[model samples]
Target: MSETTEKDLYAVLGASPSDPVQELRRRYQQLALQYHPDRLGNECSSEAESGVKKFLEVDAAWRLLSDQSTRRQYDLQRRARELKQDWPVDSTVCLDDMTWDEDDCVYTHSCRCGGRFSITEEELEEETQRKQEDVGEKEKEEEQHREAVVCCDTCSLSVYVIKDVKS
Candidate 1:
């Protein structure tokens, strides 16, 4: 629903992920002014069109990042993207495929890269909470509790395990 569905807001505004709210606002204002269609009214049609598009993108990014709730959601999605990029998920495994370690209280699956993908109960519970908060009630009713991906710490490998419903 947010305009930042595809592009990274921070990148679009030329700000860091950890940038302060004031800094983000300042950057957005500058970019908005630079790319405003009205400011380039006398420019060539092609250039004006490009400027309009960029202006819209900048406005959308600011809209999503300026709101606290939307910003939190965006941050969560961004973090997930970064994690996936770093780990490069290699395979999917069901809960049955994993070996449960009682002492460590985690489910572990072996990775092809000589590492292991593990998920703890706490992580599963946290993920469930996040999902419930993210989706609408109607959507939640239609969706079943799904699997979670766990990444290997030592290598670019990962696995998906059906999160324990009881947890």
Candidate 2:
């Protein structure tokens, strides 16, 4: 793949985003050994050159993910990209603009087409649980503040709900 193409770093190291640091390190080492240029020594073929390029990419991914700060930044960027890809580009109402419905326990925002975009409390809670399960306690704490994307019930529009922090 071209360098400009968006690559999932976790995929490069053959690990999941939820994988522990040790597991990530292990996988990186395994991939490095398999793709290292020296490992394919005395070869001047295209395959050998490809292996070296892959090794470099794998090493770069590991370097970013192995560090807690860089990983957090990467996660934020990745999430933003995913949100853009998953939701309607032009329809992004902020949580502050939504009306909170006490009965339904959801934040609702009106779409231009008259459809309402809503996100229920249960949905936010479930998302939090999933994140906690995937990223572990430490990272979960660091990422306590997050935005949830909710779609309009009638139209293809969407909105972002900034969940209230729970005690």
**Clash count in backbone of candidate 1:** 0
lDDT tens readout by residue for model 1, 50-161: 9999999989889888888988999999887764453455766777768999999988877777788888877866766566666778786765556566779678667666
Q: Say which candidate scores most in TM-score.
A: 1
Give the alpha-carbon lDDT of every model.
0.79, 0.78
> Candidate 1, overall lDDT?
0.79
Question: TM-scores of all models?
Answer: 0.62, 0.57
What lDDT does model 2 reach?
0.78
Candidate 1 stretches greater than 4 Å from native: 1-4, 73-89, 92-103, 122-146, 162-167
Q: What is the Å distance of residue 147 in model 1 from its true position?
A: 3.8
Q: Give RMSD to native, each candidate.
A: 5.1, 10.2
